[model samples]
Target: MSDTTHAPRAILADDERLMREQLRSRIAEVWPELQIVAEAKNGLEAVELTREHKPDLVFLDIRMPGLTGVEAARQIAQLPEDDEWAVPEIVFITAYDQYAVEAFEQGACDYVLKPAERDRLLVTVERIKKRLAQRSGEAEPDGPSNGTLQQLLHSLSARVNPGGAPKYLQWIQASVGQTIQMIPVEDVLFFISDEKYTRVQTPTVEALIRKPIKELVDELDPALFWQIHRSTLVNVKSINGISRDFRGRQLVGVKGLDEKLEVSRSYTHLFKGM
Candidate 1:
């Protein structure tokens, strides 16, 4: 659907060569004109291939040796932009448990179960084709937001745990100079990002950890650590009240904390009046 001058190109990335071959052969059958440009055996290779080829589509496998499929997609999504380039459509090739596959219901991206099914793939192909047409300037393009994709990737990563349920963190081990401290999650008042580090503040003391808020969002109980801003998450129990700044911005006041966090417009609904 992209520029009728030629077939849209694609890259296939999976650890197993046999699985890649099988998927390639199957896709050829379903979408004959679509060109298979390259194949990669790992997540790192996938990103490299995508960068070199700039293909219109990329099929990624979730689990790889060093980097994960989600991580690869994250990089691909952030690849340098150009007036002539459009980010490739991404499809995940997952050999996930049945429970884990349910995470795809949100339709964040197209996916195919292992040992791909022709009938099911037919539907996926049709939908993808329509989106490609939209991107080709046939109509307005519609896709999931970056935040939605972040949440989807988070849900997919949690499946790495047994039984497809995430085990939330109860304690945080942070290093302080020569001492390592065990900080209970209940004692933390808030977390804010500081470039590569995350500052963890408790009622009595503060500490730093390398874990970013994006990573912590899944590891912590969401009901307790509500995200009031992009770079900040506050413990629900530690929140004293919500107030508005003179500029009409929502400010979250934390118990025992002097500085109030400015709530981004995207998250003001979290403090909506009942």
Candidate 2:
């Protein structure tokens, strides 16, 4: 048995409220000692929270509003380490599919299918426990690396479709008070959701749109913009730096903005190196 002094921590990421709750309940029953430090509604948040909490394990839903689970996992694996915490063990929460399960096994990554069955969850929990025990007192070298994650993602993408690419948004028609502003996507600093309307921030103009952040993500370029929270997507070029607040929350500094943008716990992975 491993030393009992250190209890494990974990984060769960899923867009569905009910799914998160269900997984939490199941994990609690199987591994009562494992603490759920945070929960995320999308892949971006999943990556960020993993950076902030440095949890020993994470459960990522395959599909989410912003980044997919595979995308988030790739970033998480690549996060520069300050030795504050080890890279977490990843457990993909996927809808039942034989091909997906096979891919996960080939990558040597663990997974739990959706609507988690107690027996299945028990198996995953026991495997994690065994892995943890085996690594006790050893250096953190067991978790998947960026290269491994990237290979897995590439393989999966190839299986989905070859030579297909998504078309990203180039411009946004947002309302500014009484006027309709045509905003180039490159000029946008960030998009923050406020219930029904999403606020678009640029250097010179702030605009509002009826589209929600969830919908806007499909139209946005994943490489140019990154979601740091369920409600926030920021342009990669617009970010100057990242800093932590008094509460230990990561905040993003824009090039010209006086006020810093809050990076929610679930989206901290984007600036883990910083």
Candidate 3:
């Protein structure tokens, strides 16, 4: 992530479309000068768009599909240093109150709740503006670097899965006609879902499951099945390549499959130059 420009730019990422819009609108009210360059609907997209835009700040929802906000923040913190821009400041936007203790540990990262009350948002905006102004005044602007933030992030990450990470679904149970078939998750190429059924594609066969995308996201390992769209999760190892159409939307090619999966605008940042 980079922040070479003096003018502030920010990005919002959340799975809830309405929540994102609401936050954007509220932020606009609180800080009219802060430009929202882009929006993402998931944590994966949040990380990708941050890298692509190099915004001055990133507002992330703690809970999202594929990757959590804390995980995304860790990735942003570790992004390679760029001469053109500095890494962006991270702020957590969450409704969960349990993370508050860890969040405020050593005054790590700023946060706003789900509804984002105007008064609270104003405070958050002021703090962010102050930090940005401090950076702009410096001779060499580097991203926000504080050891407390890293510790806070680690504590938050561990708090998310206090006991340990649950075993991700390794075998998917799908209905093939009248017979139920067990498909190994690793062998599957991709999974797409609609309102009623989720289509599971493998090299040898295709199957359908009653599970919706939202539910499946929790059971699947985010590292293995990368979310390409709200209703689609493609296996990382199955990615053959990427291509584009006339309209400029990106498409992902899967190995052992001829069809290319559509990459939603929220996820185009994953492909670099969408």
Tell me, what's the RMSD of every candidate?
16.4, 16.2, 15.3
lDDT of 1 by residue, 60-124 (tens): 87666446677788788778757656667778876554523554576667888766778877877
Better of 2 and 3 by TM-score: 3
The TM-score that candidate 1 achieves is 0.54
Write one digit per residue (lDDT tens) for candidate 2, span 1-274: 2242489888999876657777898898988999999999888999989888787788887656577676777778777665345567778887635537765576446888766788999988877776665456544546455467668866654543336666355567577886555578999999999887889999999888777898878779899999999999999999998888899888889999987889887787778767
Best by TM-score: 3
How far does residue 136 in candidate 1 sit from its true spot (Å)?
A: 1.7
User: Can you tell me which runs of candidate 2 are displaced by over 4 Å?
Assistant: 1-5, 138-146, 157-274
In Å, residue 177's CA in model 2 sits off its true spot by 43
Candidate 3 residues 105-201, lDDT tens each? 5556788876678899998887777677666664444334556677788888887666677636656656677555657799999999998889999
Local distance difference test values of all predictions, in order: 0.77, 0.77, 0.79
Highest lDDT among the candidates is held by which one? 3
Candidate 3: which stretches are off by over 4 Å? 1-5, 138-144, 167-274
Q: Which portions of model 1 show Cα errors greater than 4 Å?
A: 1-5, 97-103, 161-274
Model 3 lDDT on a 0 to 1 scale: 0.79
